[model samples]
Target: MTTSDGEAKGEGIHAWHRQAVNDPNPQTLTATSAGHARRRPDHLAVICEGREVTYAELHRRSNQTAHALLAEGLRRGARVAYLGRESEHYFEIALGCAKSGTVLVPVNWRLTSREVDHILRDSDAEVLFAEREFRPVADRLRPVLPGLRTVIEMDTPGSLADGFLDWRAGHAETDLDPGTGRDDAVVQMYTSGTTGLPKGVVLAHRTYFTLMEHMTRAGLNWYDWHPEDRSMSCFSSLHSAGMGWFMVGFAAGCTNVVMRMFVPEEAVKRVHEDGVTVMQAAPAMLRMLLAEPGATPDAFASLRKMIYGGSAIAPPLLRQCMERLDCDLAQMYAAAESGSVVTCLAPAEHTPDNPRLGSVGLPCPGNEVRIVGRDGEVLPAGRVGQIHARTPALFIEYWHQPEATREALVDGWLCMPDAGYLDDDGYLFVLDRLDDAIIVAGQNIYPAEVEMALAEHPAVAESAVVGVPDQRWGQAVKAAVVFHTDQRATARDLMVFLRGRIADFKIPTQYDFVDDLPRNPTGKVLRRMLRAQA
Candidate 1:
């Protein structure tokens, strides 16, 4: 098979990509409740802290929430915002919005009042479900955001709330469906762009369903789920991957063990006590988990698979996770706009010294990957270009941003702002984000490639590479590094070690010793912050 350009297509277009088993498939996001409530009424749906919610409870509570939202004058398709950390209530609001045909917009609790206001106003959300801790911020922004009509305060667990719970309890618990279809938008997720302002990526119910169908149909062991599997949702729902992960578990009728926050020590304790079998986390989170004193083979004994992504992982970190955790490691490469995990490094590919470890692996079923050059021409094998994908699970559009939408969705392909190449066997090797590339003396330098070299150094704990203004070369490579607690290294030592590891120009001309690299809530390195500081 070949592409339109007459070039041999990647492994993503293989014959088996269309195969499917004769199992029932959910047609909408609301099926997470509507489908599961009937199948596993008494089974545990969500376990958070000391609280447990069964499938029946989730359905009933979320239905009550849906009735409340409609009763509060929220029309179908209206944006409903949630400003709080992950909790059982958050899922209720999410599923309720899905049931009521209101798009769920999860605000990053870590954002400032101003940033939160921007998202609320930008999304034009009518109803805001906020935790008591963040009520002050919500109150401060309400008068300014005229579109924000209702503010329902969510109380802590077991407390009779005068706001969220009380209002929800007043509504009917009977199932109320608003006729949300597969094409209806379920979530309007805001992602920080290069401009630093949040852009809402509106995802439809079909986004989740399409990905699930393809993954299930392919019969891939990379990310399978079972009803008895106790999966962990450690990442925040504001992160799309976290939301998708939670939905995947819910749709599979699995018992989700929720972590209100990602504390390595606490995570180790939960895995040991709860018998969690499958979970996903970022590489940084895995590193922290392995660093904990209680993190032993026995601690993760019941864990069968660990799916990781969010950023490019260093080989040392990957090897550490494979060795210390002693479990199957699957690496996913995806963006919110492209659904989740278009490309994945399966467990079998996690070999000790395999070169394929550097690649993000072949595309998943019903997904196509292509490398396009600056001139919009399709690049041949082994040629570096912008990575693009045609996936069945692509987001609808960036809310109200027509120009941005047109720019992102080109010729039916979701454009990823990343630079990479495809090998002959169709393996994708991601260098780094094209915007993060440092141009030095007409040579393109990718930070991930340089950071990979720095990881080879024994004393380097973590490092972030960024471009600094150079009087001679326009831009010079700089690195901010954190060393191991018991070890230390000099800039000269690192430079000497990286001399032959990567291109000389790609090596950092200057270095800063820091306690840690700045990261977002999702554990993605804030390279823009590093560049601003440099």
Candidate 2:
């Protein structure tokens, strides 16, 4: 990556790299001793499966894990795969990798063995840290992965099968060189694979530090955080938002809480019992919490800020949350390539009186957003077009994908393929994906409009709309809905519901009711999967 004014170079990145090189932050150590030095090391840092790991213990264990990896002769920049469901070990291993200066690759546990194999192969991983439950899958693929140097099983002795090294034992807590700087890659996140096969998105140390600085200056109010602040994270560490956000909370010296898996009732209980002040989750998780019985304002009384994103939050759901949760609800819009957040709807703007209730809010400082037409012409306010952005947090490139890198980035700007428009007040409103649009009789119809309309119905809990090939109108609108309960509704009733809300052309020509709709682990509806079923 060459440094040029128009080619994405900034003082923030340079300064952060300089600081890491000169005097590395002691907090970078993933051990309890360092955590104790900051303040109360005995304070809780992780809570999962009814077990708690204090900051001191979490730090110590992570440091030990780092030594174990180094003992295996792992070098800096070596790609190591972390394959497991949510657990305290996930945090320990991830931070351990960071401490060792080895690039961490977190694979989604929801993926099948085949999918996991693809990622391991594509990443050229040298080692794999896997849970005992997934040992069988790993054993099956180990032969195919010639580059794999070791397999560390994350389970107690006698729990793992015969051929793997015990991850917990057999290494001295030796200090390793910490490579901190703008040039060092810290993480490699795979794309969601919604459009196609997933590609690795490499993020550098400078990218993360720059994002934190941008958020702090742009009104995240994160500087107010203290050691007493208890933060909870339900998002997986594999994604940029999950691990990235948690690291920011850690940097602020807050007690970090973790959930092994997201259960709405358990989540509510943890907030009240743990006295969590800040929390981050997807919109679907929020909806589930609100729908639970006995859920009320008191359930979230300890919460100071509730951050939601990764999917659209319908108007009704947002309004209901404001009335019931009684906490500041903030929305963030981001992508892996952009290092997590590009725009955010601040806590103050999340009011009933705010006109841009459904809008994604303004861009962060030093980030530029433009709505451009197909011909690359910039569109005026309120005109729907492709959303493009340029920021210092942007990734260097897609690993080993030169053609894809060239197509996605143009003149230092990332062509986000999402369709949306900026309002006169500069607030952005994402309509739908540019590729997901349907052209019927020369009129463009976005599925998000129909999905939003269907979401208004009391019986409809969640919905997804797609365009299917049609000989008559060139393409036809189709909808797949998941209901709140076992209650059933006919396609005619839904069509009537939409007829009164939107234009006739935008209404779905076909409706399918299923037990549940297909969604990725992050809760993004896989329209391609739905369309394949259609």
What is the number of backbone collisions in each predicted candidate, taken in the order shown? 0, 5
Model 1 lDDT, residue 496, Cα: 92
Q: In the order shown, what is each candidate's alpha-carbon RMSD?
A: 4.8, 5.9
Model 1 worst lDDT run, 10 consecutive residues: 11-20
- Against the true structure, whose TM-score is highest? 1
Instruction: Please provide, for model 2 over 1-534, each residue's C-alpha lDDT reduced to its tens digit, 9 standing for 90 to 100.
Output: 112211232322323233333445422433323545346667777776667788667666767777877777888888889887767778778777877778889988887666787889899899998877787888999998899999877766564222233455666554445656554677889988888778888887656556555544443442235556788876776777888777766655567777766778888888888888888888888888888774767778888778898878877888888888766677888888887577777776776987888888888767889999989999999999999988887887787788888888899888886899999988999888888888888889988888888989878988999989999888899999888786667898888888869999999989888888788876788899988887
Task: Give Cα distance to truth, residue 5, candidate 1, Å.
Answer: 29
How well does each candidate superpose onto the true structure, as a TM-score? 0.94, 0.89
Give per-residue CA lDDT, model 1, range 277-385, as digits (tens).
8888887888888899999889999998788887888889988887787667888899989976789877878879789999998898899999999999999999999
Off by over 4 Å in 2: 1-40, 157-170, 218-224, 486-488
For candidate 1, give the lDDT. Answer: 0.83
